[model samples]
Target: MDSQQPKQPKVLWLNVIVFTVTFAVAAIGTPLWAWHHGFDLAQFIMLGVAFTFTGMSITAGYHRLWSHKAYEANSVLKVIFALGGAFAIQNSILHWASDHRIHHRHVDDNDVDPYSANRGFWYSHIGWMLRDYQRNRYADYTNCRDLQKDKIVMWQHKYYLPLVLLTNFGIPLVFGVLHGDIWGALILIGFTRLVLNHHTTFFINSLAHIWGKQPYTNKNSARDNGFLALLTFGEGYHNFHHIFENDYRNGIHWWQFDPTKWLIKAGSWVGLTTKLRITPEERIEKAKATMLLTRLKTRLSVSDENQRRIQLIQFEYDALLARMTDYYAMKKRFFDLKKRRLLKKYERADLLNQLQKMKSELQQQRKTWYSLAASYSY
Candidate 1:
């Protein structure tokens, strides 16, 4: 078969029909009905609350906790996430994590990647789900063996249909009845909230790859965009997440809008989450430095500069990277020594002295590295 004209898998009529009808209801029905009979403040408020719960479930629970094992959540939290996942109307945790693992493992490969963004925006965003392009891929969820072992995950997968109906409809109906407006709640919270959640999550696979800066690595299409992160519950930091998949936080900085990371951290305080994985700060800085050096080299390659000048800059870049490597190595050793000191009954003065010396050396090395890096721009 021609590479461009690959065999089209069977169409998923259920998904096709559901997405179409819901989208129509959200787009046309919402405006028409609202215009005729405006929904009350309570219904709008319910939509916002429902959106937050379901969206965070996917980000903090499914994506970070289950899919990447970035952190461990207690059984109660897991059950809550399961219910939220069903309410969000995404597939079962097993299936969602399986496709995600494949996407990360074979990103940009149209043949294997369940939703290769390189195919096009629409295709990556929603087209992949519309057609059964990889029917067996979803069925063969061996990639999600770890998740399958999770009781909450397995239980949700086994009873996903009933749970979906219960959360999606039951919750809305209950809220509507309490608010004395079943139709209003269903339209606002049910249709509008679901449609918004679906599209925002889909943006990570589509727009995240297309727009934004690739500061960490350009090996794949993923890019980091703060704007997208705000919409997708901090998933907009796609480039960082792609490079540091196991890190519990996508938005590494404190100021980054990663509510999911905040939720996970908050859960830990109450014994609801544990073992949150985090990338070392030095490693993240090193990745950024390496990408900068790569960019500079590419620029020099296409420049009409003197050979001697280019060689000089290249030498400086290599030296800075070597210094950075040494600094991180020393820092690692210092941390290891500190860990040993804390764990062991006896604390040696000499060990503490050595750690302090290493820490000072690392600080000096970091200063030198930054100075050298700054010189390149001049």
Candidate 2:
């Protein structure tokens, strides 16, 4: 049955009310409040702090740490994340991770994926939350057995409501009273920040699929949008994320705006995080090259002259792959031997020289392959 015309599910009045009220306050009330009494520096500073805590909690703590096990954090970090997750008002870690795991397992399936983007914008964005679409699985968190084992995760789940109320209202009210402007704190830190966070997170479900380029793979609707990454705390590299779901870094490149990745990495320096997982560069490169070759092949198949270009491209691509395989293989071996501490100093030096040579050759071949692909006119 199409989600568009399916039997209507019971509307979750609580969610509807919460979403509607918060949005109204943020949209209408904030401006009105600002009109009467201007926002202060304290309120703005608190808003940034509150937003960062909640946003990073969701991206780094909920999504990467729990949903994908992309990295591990210490107990102290876990507790902070738990509190921040409650502050974010998304859901219990168990529920969020379970739903997310299911979504990945059945990405495009309307009947299975909790927020299947194929169902259209509104449905994927917020409509799914407006109704009891997965009532049967509301309490069935079998998918999050790992999260269930974590004490902080279970504790947060047990006290989520109280935590939510405290962090959302209590904390904001405190900041307001302390700053001598209770209403401003509530408007900016409490409502406005929540509204912005909600929609930005929702954009990953809706706009992320609808917009952006698919540089990695078109196997799914996920896309890589840098602008979205900036808004979502670095979750906008959707295409790369879908393919390398377990990788700790969504934006693999240093230039990419993945603050969550940086935060996790910095945590490692302080012993707050460890075992950050990353996809092998060889695998990432191959996936990219395969996608590029597949696209070019489709374009080249349109004409005989273009068809000839395919062979040349294939040759260069194959050579590049060969170089990549050799370079990575030697590099891995060099590291493995070094780790074992069994290699003589001279043997290590010889291996290091060979690895550098292979790396240089690989780089040259990559440039040549890309140049060859670009040489042919469409």
lDDT of each: 0.87, 0.92
> Best-fitting candidate, measured by TM-score?
2
* Model 1 lDDT per residue over 184-262, tens place: 8898899999999999999999999999999999999999999999998999999999999999999998899999999
Worst window of 10 by summed lDDT in candidate 1: 343-352
Off by over 4 Å in 1: 1-7, 302-306, 342-378
lDDT at 189, model 1: 92
Q: How accurate locally is residue 339 in candidate 2, as Cα lDDT from 0 to 100? A: 93
lDDT of 2 at 156: 95
Give TM per candidate: 0.90, 0.96
Q: List the residue pairs that clash in candidate 2.
A: none
